[model samples]
Target: MDLLSIKDPSFLKKLSIKDLELLSKDIRKFLIENLSITGGHIGPNLGVVELTIALHRCFNSPKDKILWDVGHQSYVHKILTGRASHFSTLRKYKGLCGFPKRGESEHDVWETGHSSTSLSAAMGMAIARDLKKEKSFIVPVIGDGALTGGMALEALNHIGHEKKDMIVVLNDNEMSIAPNVGALHNVLGRLRTAGKYQWAKDELEMLLKRIPAVGGRVAATAERIKDSLKYLLVSGIFFEELGFTYLGPVDGHNLENLIENLNYAKKTEGPVLLHVITKKGKGYKPAESDKVGTWHGTGPYKIETGVIIKPENTAPAWSSLVSETVRRLAREDERIVAITPAMPVGSKLEGFASEFPDRMYDVGIAEQHAATVAAGLATQHMKPFLAIYSTFLQRAYDQVVHDICRQNLNVFIGIDRAGLVGADGETHQGVFDIAFLRHIPNIVLMMPKDENEGQHMVYTAIKYDDGPIAMRFPRGNGYGVPMDKELKEIPIGTWEILREGEDAAILTFGTTIPMAMEAASELEALGYSVRVINARFIKPLDEEMLTQLFEEKIPVLTIEEAVLHGGFGSSILEFAHSHQYFETVIDCLGIPDQFIEHGGVNELLCDIGLTSEKVVEKVLTLTREKQKRV
Candidate 1:
């Protein structure tokens, strides 16, 4: 079967279970092959092949409203819905999105890249469907790991209470990104292994009746015994207590089982939680064996060997450098503790976990709790390093402001992937951290130029006991700069002058520093003396340097890889205005007011006019405009 010929899921209703099984195999093979050339969430998609097939077949999509939580596992859904031909260009520049995009197809009703948002969205849809008096089955397929998120739990509570007509598929792969944590995961584990627990509960009740009760009152006190037995013998008593009709821990790979359960769930009233057990990386050997989430999302790989392709890399990855540095410092600093929200693998914190097992915490998918936990640790005089992706930290903004910033705690926040992450698109990009965090009171935000400076800044953040401080590091490898033998602390709120000039200045930091340097050289060749400054401290503007530049009346250009509005460039603009240096001709350049899509980092930068050529052009214009002012 040519998967590219698939137009929509309507044809699926005509197929038999055996045909669907064959289709699942074909889909798996297609994903494994296509994803080898163009990397994606292969492991997750493979796991959901049968499950997705059953979903589209059992319920009508675009009408019945099937929603994928996180949307990475929607590749099979995409294949069933006429996007297989675009798999070659998947995650490329102007290509098929890595996640569901509403603009791409009518089938993609909701666009999601972040996890644990599906249930809430599904609830909203369900409410709307009822308001309009429309009849449709609302199904939201959420993973077991995402079930641990506070938002997911809150949605479950609300959805269960509301008693909406929906099927909540709990896709239990036993892990999310990394191996799951929390008591909820343990509950799913028991449910996954023991499905006959309800039967055992009935037998236990019969046995309990035969036993003696206090004061021969079996009716009154035995109910308490039944309550205890609910936890012990009822596999899905958790969801049942939450007002949901619990279904089987069905084998997600079995097409017949999945279709049967889904069909039954659709007919059942209120909220039906269909617990489906599936393995992550179901068919592939290497991906299935990946316990550290290496195959969760990946770059290109060799299909025959199952080996991930890579360029020759001498530089350490930013996450590894930051986490390893934290691990190194943890050995000497007993008070230091590390924390992450379901991202130990991505943040490269395995070494830290191994060395300081007692001090390391992986709060499962709960970013809000992770932020406040660090604040709690800081109150007792313990240095806590909260390692979280910039995108995920957005979910915990209130905790950051209310708990961490308000108390003025010594919490060092290592904001991983703090720039335009290319393939994951707008949802995963870390561009908004500076804009979001800089305005918060008593919070210091900064980005380092290279790996060496990053380590020093990490040291600076850990040692600085003033208030909450955060260091931003990009997604991929560093610039391979030589690290210092002894770690040192950079002065707080100070900027580094990379090159000095009189005509014009380029103020930038982190990943954009090299581009600024390149532009400076280009301007110099054209006879314009361009100054380059590493304006690393985003919150605290280099006021002394700004004052000097303003007094000299040098035209300036602010370059950032972040959003221009309310970003580092805006900070510089606010400084010029507040200080009343309105004469300083400042030009801001960065990601314009729009969502950047999936593409190569360089491609995205070029499209957004953040390249060196743009830099040179902007600087030349600023210099020429300044001369005209004179």
Candidate 2:
């Protein structure tokens, strides 16, 4: 059958096991070919081909809800649910989303990008179903690695206590972006190798019955021996004790086994945890061998050779520059330590970890715990460098505010991907950090214009002893500018004048600085002198420069690659208002009050009018207003 022409998974129920196996091959071929061009969560999707097919065969979707935890592995589900035709435009702007989108298809009942949310969402859906007298199966396919999340554990406890009618599919691939850690992971490791427990339990029960009840003492002894068997044979007793009936260490790749277990789960009363073991990147050779999680998500690649297609001689990634700088400083400063919420590779902290194994901490997927851990480190006069993605940092907002900022601890937060992160879509965009963090007291938020400034900002953040300091950098490579022989710390709250002019001022920082400079140059050609200032420190407004601009009566245009509300630009506006400089004409350009979708960064910038063209237009408009006032 042609994969693209598939309208629904209803046909899957009619197909034989042999035909389903052939269909799985076709689906894998389709994904390997299409994702090689468009690029997506290839490893994850490949791993779930049979599992997804088995699920659709076992359940009636749209009626019986299937929620994918993290949703990166839902590409196979998408293909089966009439979305194979959209593969070419996967993760592109105004096209197919990388994650499950409720608006895209009726089959996609739950949307997810972050991990550990499916169990909680499933609980809510289960409650609603019971309240409405609805009869439908609720299955939440969560990964074993996601189970380590505090929220997932909390939901599990609640789910078991309530005994809601739901099937929790634990897709144990033994990885969540990177290798899973913690005691829960160890428990799963034992389960994975322990094989099926039901057979052993049955044999033990048969032997116990044969032993007979001779007397009260003998009966009690038999009962104790039977209970001890659970400790030895029942690998999933951990979940069983929590009120869920545990099934399998089932083979996820086996269609027959998956279908059988799923059907059993549907028939079972209360909650059931169907543990299905899968291999990440099961089909593709290169992805299957990926130990460091580079193939977890990727750009376009050569499918035959497994070679990633990237631009030649790209500048160092911002993450590497900042992380390496921290590593270098860590050598001199014994007090410095590195911490990440399972993002050592993404944050480029592998070097730091390797160099100072004792000092580096990979705190699994617990962002809240990581934040508080940094605060704890700071209280002991240890400089804790908490490296986290801006989007994930939102999960630890309370910790950042209460534990770190409130006590004014000396913590260095390396906010990676601190702007519009393309390809991962709306959920992974780092545009809200400025809006969320700028309001917190004793928290210094700053971004850098280039890799050189980024390195300096790292130095400044680590050197600053007053309070909690965060330096945000965008995703992808730097501009490849020439570096200085020595590193230096920039003064806090001081804006740098990249280009001096008399007529108007363009204030911006980080990735937006180049756009501002380009716009200023364009204005210069049209006989409009536009001054470009790098307002790097987002929290602390550059008061001296603001006073100068206001005194000169020069109109200001603030540009940021962040949300407009309460962002860097908002800080400038608030400064002008507080200082009583009411006549100063200020225009702002940034991400509008909407979530930006996955696409090329430049395309996203253009869509939101954060390009040089928009800056020129805004500068022209602002200058015209200044002329009118004059």
Model 1 — which ten-residue stretch has the worst lDDT?
A: 196-205
List model 2 lDDT by residue over 496-520, tens digit each.
8999999899999999888888888
Worst 10 residues of 2 by lDDT: 211-220
Q: Give the TM-score of candidate 1.
A: 0.95
RMSD in angstroms between candidate 2 and the native structure over all alpha carbons: 2.2
Clashes of 2: 0
Candidate 2: segments with Cα more than 4 A from true spot: 199-228
TM-score of 2: 0.96
| Model 2 clashing residue pairs (backbone) | none
Count clashing residue pairs per candidate: 0, 0
lDDT of 1 by residue, 230-349 (tens): 677665588989988777788989998888778777778899898999999989999999898999999899988889998889999999999999888888999999999999999999
